[model samples]
Target: MHVTWGRNIGTTVQSEEDLYFSANSENWFDMSSLGAFDTYTSDNDWVSVEKMVPPVETDDMITTRDVSKLCEDISSLYLNEKFSDVILVLDGEKLHAHKAILARCEYLEALINDGSQHLQQSEIAITDVSPEAFKKLLKFIYTVSTITITSNVGLIVEVLELARQYCFKDLENATIQTLKSALNLKNICSTLNIANLYDLSDLKQACHTFVDQNALEIVTGDGFTDLSQKSVIQLLERDTLLVPEIEIFKSVSKCKLNDDDDNLVIGSVRLSWLTVEDIVSTVWPSKLVEDEKLLGAIVEIVEVKAKTSVCRAKKCMKNNHNWRKIDL
Candidate 1:
């Protein structure tokens, strides 16, 4: 019997004559026919397919295992996980604390040398700083270990705090040296105040000694006005040698003879032996020969009275003819 086949179907024989073509062959023929239908239709189908299908993205999975591996790699340098733990602990502390430990480490390294060769040769004793301290120091070096001076006075003082807490002698010495360089009368006052508060006997003594030695500069200038009365008194008391020049005399008579005013005069009768030459040189150039002769006579008479009375025997000085002065 004759049977109708779908359009574009390929010829295929079946067991029965009812249908000789297969639907698969007809479907393949239909798909090939669709390609020639229209470019727009093919484009539309592709566009719809693309919109229906979600975009694929590359996955960058950063898991805890990866982080742990990274940390393990870093910890390999020290060959210990405990060091990594210490680093994590250091990260949790204050940023300054971390920096201080680092600075201390650098200072220790410079002081001791690589592999502690210098430490061994010099035989210097190590204090509270141990292997753990070095680990903390490294954590600081890798993290933050810089101390910034925001205020003028707090810089060295804060360093001292760190040094004291960590028992770092080098750091303490560095702080003291910096303090010495920065010290002025005003700042020294603050340093002294801190020393008192902290009960730093050595620092207090150093400040006191510095102030005492530089008293002239610190106590007499415009800067001195800023100092308290107590500070001034303390400086003055300690620096007794800074007292104003004193006019010494064997007796009151010697002190009074050197009259403050003098245009020109031959040897004055009251001039002491110690100042006799000075009086002669100053007066000799201006005096007449007769006046010089008169001055010499007056000097002799005063000397005679001075020797007999010791400037206290009234009768001895009264009997001397030189005691009765003439206008000449």
Candidate 2:
């Protein structure tokens, strides 16, 4: 806020900048620059505005405690169909709700009130979501709280999917955060798969970062093999993957043995980074030999080895360094 003091004598200006954007009008501003202090009054001869102080905040404490009971009462009314106007047929189970559910949820509002035939009957069918997960969603919508998602990865995944499908962005974000807390090496791949499939950008980044930072252990784990071909390709493509290229190729080979994927590219790996002996004895003579994609990589390795030999012959070269041996 830029506050400019007027130079004119006997002029007073009282002002309040709504920096916080609070609804209260009681903002106190000392206006001594205009004139000498006098009794506070709503007079214009001077900057006669009275100081406004916001009322005390006692209501918030009360409301926070009262909202739970209010939610329970409203939920009771909904279940008893006291004023319910709609029924959700979730996997053959009837769930009662008011028209407000449509108002609160985007997909429900679109499906129920946007000229669907089901609107007339006040009944909508949800065939994909399980009844229990649907119930958990309703509880959150009605109570303004999320169900416990800790150590309940499956339930969290289901709810997270529902949140995304229904366009509940706040709930989707909350579920993603919950999923982040639950993530570990064991379930990282599965969570990453869901994040990718559901297009959860933040969660996807989190999973990718976790795997990239722990690439060594992760690549050796069972979860790495369980990853979708797309996930594996993405992991391999990241320059941030810190595991040795040799281990990565081993894991990729294992994955290839179980499921044939044409999209798995080996170019991301600096094949030259593998020692020449290792390449000749292990990499080339083994599984890498049959793969056509590695043909160029194998050639690159040989070229690097030749360069290293020349550098060694030059003697001035430090450790016969081959620039191609460096991996990004």
Candidate 3:
């Protein structure tokens, strides 16, 4: 019998009566045990067999059993003054750190390098990030223990800001994922504002989806009007925002922080979807839109609705006539 095998696989030929093969330097298998073939070829004839073996596993397998312990060991070094090469001052407190690990962050690397091969000083000051937030950042850098990141929305937002500010991509991604999972009505607006301000597209899109799903409660809820003009416009532009045009108009009217914002937000609302009375009473009083534009929009909307009503009635009447004409 002849055997064809995949590249890099070992093969050895022996007596055809009971063939044995070893795919590696050690383990060997009998052909009979593998049940690879039912019939044997004659001495004058040749049969072909092909086999491929996957890479072998050994006793010395790579394991992460010590990874967590290693992380914990490194975490103990965090904020410890011993063997510390640098100090970060923030939130009226000093943080101990190693320059080698701090270089993992682009912003911190720049600060440490300071246009030279090494740090100009052992101390760096940061005023924007709070001590609790900076400590969380350091914890993640040392241990990568995401579980310790607080579930509180406010703290998570602070962590997200520090992560972004320091250009810690892993910490930033992890924080955004946490925020995405933590999104709710009470905090969506504030979280969305941060997402928009920093142009964090993934987190921004998550916020948009959450808002779209909880459109009614979110739009009518407190803090809705405090959204940035751009965020308001994004919400108004969605066709799936299942809220009455009147309520949306009310929200948009309240969103007016300035003339430009007012015009943009008002334009985004589908005024034609509102009733004539709604436009006159609610929208007209606000005067967000000009008299001529609002009047024209209302007139056009009323005409379209009237035409639609007449067509529907005519269709019903025709269907009735057909029913009556048919023999029962």
Which model scores highest in TM-score? 3
Tens digit per residue, CA lDDT, model 2, 59-112: 455665587787777666545576789888887778788777546777877777
The C-alpha lDDT values of all candidates are 0.41, 0.64, 0.72
Q: Lowest summed-lDDT stretch of 10 residues in model 1?
A: 244-253
Total clashing pairs for each candidate: 2, 5, 0
Candidate 1 Cα misplacement greater than 4 A, ranges: 1-151, 199-202, 220-236, 241-328
Ranking by TM-score: 3, 2, 1
Model 2: lDDT of residue 286: 62
RMSD of each: 31.2, 8.9, 8.9
> Candidate 3, which segments miss by more than 4 Å at Cα?
1-61, 113-124, 147-152, 306-328
Worst 10 residues of 2 by lDDT: 308-317
What are the TM-scores, per candidate, against the unseen true structure? 0.29, 0.67, 0.73
lDDT of 3 by residue, 77-196 (tens): 878898899888886688889987777778887888885634677778877667788888888887786734344788887888888778788998898888888888888998898888
